[model samples]
Target: MKNYFIVVEGLDGSGKTTAINTITKILNNNGIKDIILTREPGGTPIAEKLRKLIKYNIKGDEITNKTELLMLYAARVQLIEKVIKPALEKGKWVIGDRHDLSSQAYQSGGRNINQKLITYLSNMVIGKFKPTLTLYLDLPPKIGLKRILSRRKIDRIEKEQLSFFVRTRARYLEIASTDSSIITIDANQNLKQVQHEIYKILNQWLKIYK
Candidate 1:
């Protein structure tokens, strides 16, 4: 079977990590053994360093919008060129916790960067490559933030105002609406229900792809 790159996308607290784990287990049980799980902005060593800067902003220096956008692509390209593409070339399936759509939502919507710029950067960095499947867990920003706050310290991006997330979420929905490969799942439901939906989707996909 051809290798598949699956991505799980959601707000900070929408349980994407959990969903990735469940999806991994589902694939393993279904006989897909050659798999790698990775997250954006930190999959490789250099990218991990960039992740710290982007996520924590430990320097406390205000990062400009353009700088932030460039840093994100820097980390992403490193991950893709060094890790994701290589693994795919080796016929290993990859499950990503987040992917390119994130920049569209966070950078373009949250930071109000122009979509054209984002698209241009994306073309330069990744060209026509895209995930085989993307699962977007959709939830209200307030609830998502509350969930995030309950778990751990908020990161720099997570510290943004509610309105920022609202705009981000709106962009995610808008993008998902136009993309057939992107699957939107209601993340407001109970944990088990969300997982069930994901499993169902994966199972159907497997029937066709595997």
Candidate 2:
């Protein structure tokens, strides 16, 4: 079986965890059992430290947008080199909770960073590397925030104003519209409905790969 690098992209509380779990089970049921699950800014010891700083202000210091962006790329490079690439080389299907698209949406879109810098850093760090299939869970920022707020204490990025996520979603949609590898799923629907859509899409996608 061909190894695949699959990524799940979405806002906070957009059901990415559930989506990843469902995808894992589906893959297992289909005999694709050699799979590895990982998340952005994590999956490695050094990267995990960066994930903490990225998700929380440990020293209560303001993390500049540029600083945050650089840290994200640092963690991403570590993950790709140490975890994702090696797993794929070993014929393991890698399922990621988030990836580069998150930076495009959250940093470039939400933080208003220049896209050129992002493109430059992307080329510099991991040129031409991307997921084979990206499942983007689309939903309104308000709804997503509501869901997360009701469940647990929000993180640093999650504490951003509503406008930030609005721009982030817009960027997500904008990119997904033109990227053939990305499949957008409406997360506003009920759980059953959302899972049904994922199932249908994944089944069809698997056929193509086969």
List lDDT for all candidates, in order: 0.93, 0.95
Off by over 4 Å in 2: none
Highest TM-score among the candidates is held by which one? Answer: 2
| lDDT score for residue 189 of model 1 | 98
Model 1 lDDT per residue over 3-113, tens place:
899999989889998899999999999989999988988999999999998988757588888998999999999999999999999999999988899999999989999
TM-score of each: 0.98, 0.98
- Candidate 1 ranges with C-alpha deviation above 4 Å: 58-60
| C-alpha RMSD of each candidate structure in angstroms | 0.9, 0.7
List model 2 lDDT by residue over 51-165, tens digit each. Answer: 9999996685889999999999999999999999999999999999999999999999999999999999999999999999999999999999999989999999999999999
